[model samples]
Target: MNTDAALAALAALAHPTRLEAFRLLVQHEPEGLSTGQLVAASGLTQSTFSTHLAVLAKAGMVKSEKRGRQFIQRAEIDALKGLMLFLAKDCCQGRAELCEPLLAELACC
Candidate 1:
């Protein structure tokens, strides 16, 4: 991801509700979750949760598809990977040993 795209993703995830929603979606993975399900999980009004979802979509971190009458939202894993790579691109100023620990932690996930 470029600097601007990375910034946008960061800004989108900076909000609590958005971060939670994104993580929830990630847990669901390829199957994803319906918009209603997300709203219910958030314990927020549909309209309010929609605004948060919109921010995630705008940042390219989330995507939605029409499934029957409902929209299923899915986390964009590639976008997340890109953001992570961008952040660690210059890890420890090119010191491989210094970056090993960070890589190991990510590997555990």
Candidate 2:
């Protein structure tokens, strides 16, 4: 991710509602969540949820699909990972070993 992308992602997640919605989408993974379901889960009104979703979609933090009358939203895990990678891309200027722990943490998958 570039600086702009990272900033957008951070801005999208800056709101509490959007943060929780993204977490819900992440937990649901590929299955995602429909508009009504997201509203129910988040305890937000439809209008409120839509605004948050719009911000996330604009920032590339969320993906949405039309399923009949409902819009299903999914967390953009790759984009989020890219942002994290971009932030740490430089690592230690002269000490590669300093990043061993950070790299090790991502070894889970």
Candidate 3:
């Protein structure tokens, strides 16, 4: 991802509730979770959780699909990978050696 996009993604994740929501969504993986489920898990009002979801969607970190009368939210793993690559490139610069350890640790994940 470009710097601007990376910044947006990072900023979107910086919020406590948003970060929690994203992590919860990641754990659900390909199946995703309905908007109602997320609201229940978050213990937040539907409108409040929706605002958080919108921020994540705007940052390209989350995607939603309409399923019947509800929406299912999923984390955009590719966008996350892109953000990681952007940060890694910035940190390593011309020095590939500096990135090796981080890459190795990430591989474990």
Candidate 4:
């Protein structure tokens, strides 16, 4: 991805609450979570969670779908992988094994 997109994604995840919400959504993958679930999980207020969700959606890190009366927010995994690649594109002069553990976690999500 381009530098600006990367910066926006990183910025969207920079905050503690936002990062936690994003990570939770990432971990949940396609299933995602409702606003109330995210609010409880992040311990954030409704307005705060809405703001963070908007930021993430604008960054293309997440997408929201309405299911009945509630909205389900899900992480865009491909976009998240792009962010990870941007951050790790240049790492370890040699011995990529040093970063293997970090990369290994990618498979978990």
Candidate 5:
């Protein structure tokens, strides 16, 4: 992701509801979850959650597919990876040692 996209993704995740929604979607993985399921999990109204989903979608952190009559939302893991790489690149610039520990910790997760 470029700086703009990284910024957008960071901004989108900065909110509690959006962050929770993205994490929930990530847990679901490739199967994803329907819009109704997401709203129910969020304990928010459909309209309210839709707005949050839109932000995530706009940031490329969430992807939606039309499944039957509803939409299935999936977390864009690649986008997250790109953001992490972007941040790590700056921190590990000409210093691979600094990033080794961080990479090791992330591997556990």
Candidate 6:
């Protein structure tokens, strides 16, 4: 991702609630979760949770789709991957050996 996009994603995830929601969505993956489910999990009012979701959407870190009468929210894995790559693009300052350990840890995940 470009610097601006990376910054936006970072800013969106910087909030505790947003980060937690994003991680939760990631755990759900392709199937995603309904808006009500997310609000209940967050223990927040629907409107409050919606604001957080909006931030994530603006950052392209999350997406929602209309499913029947409800909206299903899903984490944007590509956006996350881009953000991660942007952050690690210069890992170990071009020293492959120095970055091997970090890559190994990521591979485990």
- Please identify which of the two predictions, 5 or 6, would achieve the higher lDDT against the true structure: 6
Model 3 C-alpha lDDT per residue in residues 1-109, reported as the tens digit of each score: 8889988999999999999999999999999999999999999999999999999999999999998998999999999889877877778878989888988997898
Tens digit per residue, CA lDDT, model 6, 3-106: 99999999999999999999999999999999999999999999999999999999999999999999999999999999988998898797899789888999
Range of the 10 consecutive residues with the lowest summed lDDT in candidate 3: 84-93
Q: How well does model 1 score by local distance difference test?
A: 0.97
Lowest summed lDDT across 10 adjacent residues in model 2 is found at 85-94
Q: Please report, in order, the local distance difference test score of every candidate based on alpha carbons.
A: 0.97, 0.89, 0.93, 0.88, 0.94, 0.95
Question: Could you tell which candidate, 3 or 4, scores higher by TM-score?
Answer: 3
Q: Sort all candidates by TM-score, best to worst.
A: 1, 6, 5, 3, 2, 4
Superposed model 5: Cα runs more than 4 Å off:
none
- The backbone clash count of each candidate, in order, is 0, 0, 0, 0, 0, 0
The regions of model 3 sitting more than 4 angstroms off are none
- lDDT of candidate 6 vs native? 0.95
Q: Please give, for residues 4-103, the per-residue lDDT of candidate 1 as tens digits.
A: 9999999999999999999999999999999999999999999999999999999999999999998999999999999999999887886899889999
Q: What TM value does model 3 have?
A: 0.91
Lowest lDDT 10-mer window, candidate 4? 86-95
Model 5 residue 11 lDDT?
97
TM-score of each: 0.96, 0.86, 0.91, 0.83, 0.94, 0.96
How far residue 23's Cα lies from its native spot in candidate 6, in Å, is 0.3
RMSD for each model, in Å, please? Answer: 0.8, 1.8, 1.3, 2.3, 1.0, 0.9
Clashing pairs in 5: none
Compare candidates 5 and 6 on TM-score and give the better one: 6
